[model samples]
Structures are given as structure tokens and as C-alpha cells.
Target: MERISTCLKFYLLEAGNDGSIEHVDKALIANLMTLFFAGRDTSGALLTWFFWLISKNPVVENKIIDEIRQNLAENASPKHIFSNVQELGKLVYLHSALSEALRLFPTGPFLLRVPNQKDVLPSGHKVDQKTKIMLCSYAMGRNAEIWGEDCLEFKPERWLSDKGGIKHVASNNFLAFSSGPWTCPGKELAFIRMKAVAATMIHNFHVCILDGQNIVPSISAILTMEHGLKATISSRWV
Candidate 1:
């Protein structure tokens, strides 16, 4: 794949400006750099964490497999594309699992925002225009005060209501893809990619964690698996 910045630069140069275009090179460069980093960096870590979670939680993986089988039915042909996002959305359990995974290990880990004017937060914390605030999404998601005593548990079902639609998590409760207009535009695409990769893997193999592997979470702007997720994949046919 061509380097993102190089491709972006080519496009920008192609769209010549005869005093009409704004000096958007710097902005485009910044945004492209963010996308490159977010796309490659967060995605890998998330998948690693996801497999690790599934390894220790066989029941979850099994449910995912069952969902895939039921959805595809007799057409177990691996080459077929599951083209409908709406149909994919019917895999409610998988959606919950992914959402729960992201909640526990938010890709961005923390959100930093500077106050434009003096204001007080809901928690009664006062801030001025210059004050920089860092909201620890990783920590907040796991906080008992925020998510209840069982916050640390890997329970995908928690994200579903009895009626079986998207549950209404508090606005501040889970901000993995974030909220409002600032929310990730690629959120749906990310879910599609994640679901496709996961469904493919589950259909092809049974995954188990390597014995005695120590996996740890590291926070450095992004939530990453410090030791990495080491697992053994045995082909399903075996």
C-alpha cells in the first residue's frame, strides 16, 4: 500500500488552487497522519486483545461461531461475502462482544480536550479556558462507580437490552467510538472489518492461548497489549 501521506500529498497537489483553495496542507497532513496511526496502530492492538479475550472465554467464541453458522446456514462456503451490514447487525452478540472489548480497552485510551472557556464539569471540577483535561476512558470504563461492581467482567450480554437492540449506554459511560459529531466517521466501517475478520477466523480455526503467556495492557496514547496475544490456532477441520 502506498504511504498515506504520499497519496494525500499527490491528491492535494492535483487539486491546484488559483487563489481559491485554502492552505489546507498542514491540516490534511495532520488528519492523514492521525488516520494512518489510528488505522494501523489501534486496529492491531484491538484484534490482539479481542483474540486474547476469546481464548480465555471459550463460551464467547462459541457463541460467535454459532451466530455465524446460523447466519450463513448451508452456505458455509468460505469464499462467499456477507455483503449486508444490516444482516451483519443481526449478529447482536458479536456486536456486544466487540463493544465490550472496546469499552475495556478503548483504542484511544484517553481523551484530551482544552476548555475554550471557563466551565465546570458534571463531577463539579472547575476548569478555565487554558486548562487541559484528560478523561481516562480505559479507567472510567472499568470504574465500579461508573459501570457497577462487575465492570471488569467480559460480559457482552451487558450491552444488550431484553428487547435485543442496541442498549443505551450512558453518554459518558462508553466512548470507544466516541459520541456526537466528533464521533469516528469510520465507526461502522471498523465494525464491519472487525466482524469480517473475526467471522473468518472463527470459521477456520479454534483459537487457544499459549500456556503461561503473560499478557498485559500498556497505555501510551493508545491501549496496547504490552506482551502481545500469543495463541495457538488449530484448523476447525482437525
Candidate 2:
């Protein structure tokens, strides 16, 4: 309530400058709707894919559980587990696993762009202003040239540096959150949310993907499982 009231006040103040409270209100509403949908849907999809990937790779799941337990300690209170970004930041392996999942199954799998002017791509392919180009992030992520021979494998270690820290990749090559000025504003929020939820879940539950379930990406604006993930989750906590 306090945050909403504060936002309303700011919107009204801005409206005072242009004498357009109605327009400002509409814009504010639209912005709120976009934030809610984008934040929830994309993060939900990412979590789904992340869990599926981890299920298929028990080593990765065990590593994540070990990391989370080590960071929070075995007797840490449930209320305080991964309660802050600082603590969550220390889960480097968890972060790497999330990154690997995003690499394979990006929520926004395709991006469309129209060049403002005639241009030549690195491939020497000519494109003009009228050309509409669709860049497939899913295919790009699986490309051998970009991700090497084992690109199709779910390997979180690939994102870890020799020193065991999260290795930064160029945005052009890793477009899970999009790139440039138009990048998703909630990118950081999404990571924080995912980490908190993932850590808490993994710390308390043993998630198993039901055997023989055929999972594939659905045809939608967001990358979702075609049949959804069929998983049996059991409590890990005493």
C-alpha cells in the first residue's frame, strides 16, 4: 500500500507538469501490467526449465543442494534461509546452473527486428530497411560455433571460471534477458527471485521428473514445456 501510494503521488506530480492526469494514469497502469506479466511469466518459465534440467542432471542438483546447505549451514532457520540477496549471491553453482538452463531454454526464444537502414551482416548477407529479420535465440544457443561441441549438454560448469566464480558471457551470445537499452528492466529482480525460490525449494524438497515423460518446448510467446513438467516432489527437510 505504501509503495502504491508513493507511486500514485509521483504519477500525479508528473501529471501536474502536463495537465494530463488521465494519460499519466493510463501509462502507469500499462507499465504496472507489463511489469507484473513479464516478471511473473518469464521467471516462472525459467524456473520450470531450470528444474527440468536439474532433474535430468543429478550431479548438478546435488551440487546445488550442497552449495545451498554450505552457505546457510545445516541448522539455519527456515525463515532466514536465502532471505537476502547477499546470501543468495554466494550460491555460485546455483547461479551457473540457472545460466545453463537459460542458455538451453530461453524464455523469449525468438526476437524480431527491422533494420533502420540497409546493412550487410557479418555473413555478407545484404538486408534493407524493409527487411524483417527474426533471430532465433534457441537455435543460436545450441550452435556449435557459439557454444562449442557440447552445447546441447546441460553443463553448469561451463559458466564457472577456473576460480569457481560465475563467468560473465557477452550479452550478444547470451540473450536470455535480452540485450542493450531495451533489455528487461526486471532482469536483476528475476535472478534474485529465481535464486530465492530455487534455493528454498532445493533445500527442502527432492524433485524428481517422472520417468518416460516426453517434455518439449511449447509453441507460445514464452518458452514453456509442451506437456508441462511431470515431476514428483518429496520433502527433503526433516
Candidate 3:
């Protein structure tokens, strides 16, 4: 109850005078609860795919480790926790890597929404109030026309600009977080959390994916490893 109230206060600001009571409609509460539950599998799915990509591309993993060392404080221990997200924010390569992974493997296979009014999508298709709009994010992520010929390749540098910063890809192009007025408000927080966890694990351990595991994405309702990740973990110092 306390945690839910805190979240309501932070995000919705609808926690009432005592800051502990939800003053929103029941629909809003249901949606908030859905977000909370959905977010967990989404996080786990992204991390699983990100690490799998890292394993397949040792060069990319090495670059991420190098970036971690560079951005980390000099005297910080291997187990250092990122108290300030600004520190993790400096890891451009790592961020790009995760973005690339998501580009290839969006956890949410598709997005479903009902149009509030009749409208035309950019694709020239007409949608009516009765239309149920479905956007297949997985297909969008792999579109060579949109992402270029090398779209199938796992290249983090593609997300970088000529100035060595994260390039601006339109939200519509990057549908991992959706687009327009209904875009996710928690996008920034999600990235920060992902960076912190990935950085910490990369800094402290030697993670190796063991053999004999079929690591394909499951056809389940929520995207996840079909057979689960068969991996071995050991301390870096070992």
C-alpha cells in the first residue's frame, strides 16, 4: 500500500490530501497496475536479449566494458552501485548497444490501441473510431527500408551521430517506446535502470553463455527466452 501510494504520488499526483489516497478513477488504477506488472517482464526480456547479443558479439561487449571503466569513478569498487544516474548516462556505447538490441528484439511484439476519432495514419491508411489499430513493432525494427541495408546486423555505432552522441531517431521510427502524445513517460527511467544494472554486472562478472541451450524468443504472450538462458556466471576477479 505504501509503495503503491508513493508511486501514485510520484507519477499521477493523484494521491489526495494525505498523499496516501488514490483520487483517480478505477480505470486509471487498473492501467497503473497493468503498467507495473507489464514492466517486469519487459525489463527481464530486454536484459536477456541484450546479454545474448553481447555474447554473440564479443567486440561489442569489450567496448561496453571499456566504456564502463572509463565512466566509472577511479576509486570505485567493482561492486559500486550507481547512486547518481548521470554517471551511467555517460556510457554512450553501452546505451547504443542496448538500443540496437531492442531494435532487433522488441519485447512487446505489437501495440494495440483504439482510435479516439477517425484519422489517417502516415501510411495513408484510413482509421475510424471503430478501428482497432495494431502496430507490429518487431516488423518495424527489422525493416531494411527504414533501418537501412545493415538493419539486420547488430551494430551499435548505427545509433551514434557524427558528433559522437546518440543520434535522434524519430519516435515513430523507434517504436520500442511508442510515439506521439501517448508515448511512455517512464522511458528515461527505464533506460537509466537498464544502464545501471548492465553496467554493474559487466563491471563485476564474467558471464558466459553455456552450450546446448536453444536461445530463441518464445511465442508466449510476453516475449521471453523460449528455453531460458543457459549461462554461467563467475566473479571477474576469479
**Predicted structure with the largest TM-score when compared to the true one:** 3
RMSD of each: 5.6, 4.3, 4.4
Q: Over the stretch 106-184, how does candidate 1's per-residue lDDT look in tens digits? A: 8889888888899999889999988998878888889999778999999898888999876878656777776665666
Off by over 4 Å in 2: 1-33, 73-75, 78-81
* lDDT, candidates in the order shown: 0.76, 0.84, 0.82
Candidate 3 C-alpha lDDT tens digits along 109-138? 788999888999988999998899888888
TM-score of each: 0.80, 0.84, 0.85
TM-score of 3: 0.85
Number of the predicted model whose lDDT against the real structure is largest:
2
Off by over 4 Å in 1: 1-37, 76-84
Clashes of each: 0, 0, 0
Cα-based lDDT at residue 167, candidate 3: 91
lDDT per residue (tens digit) for residues 131-218 in model 2: 9988888998999999999999999999999998989898889888777765666666677789999998888787888888888899
The true-versus-predicted C-alpha distance at residue 109 of model 1, in Å, is 1.3
| Alpha-carbon deviation at 178 in model 2, angstroms | 1.9
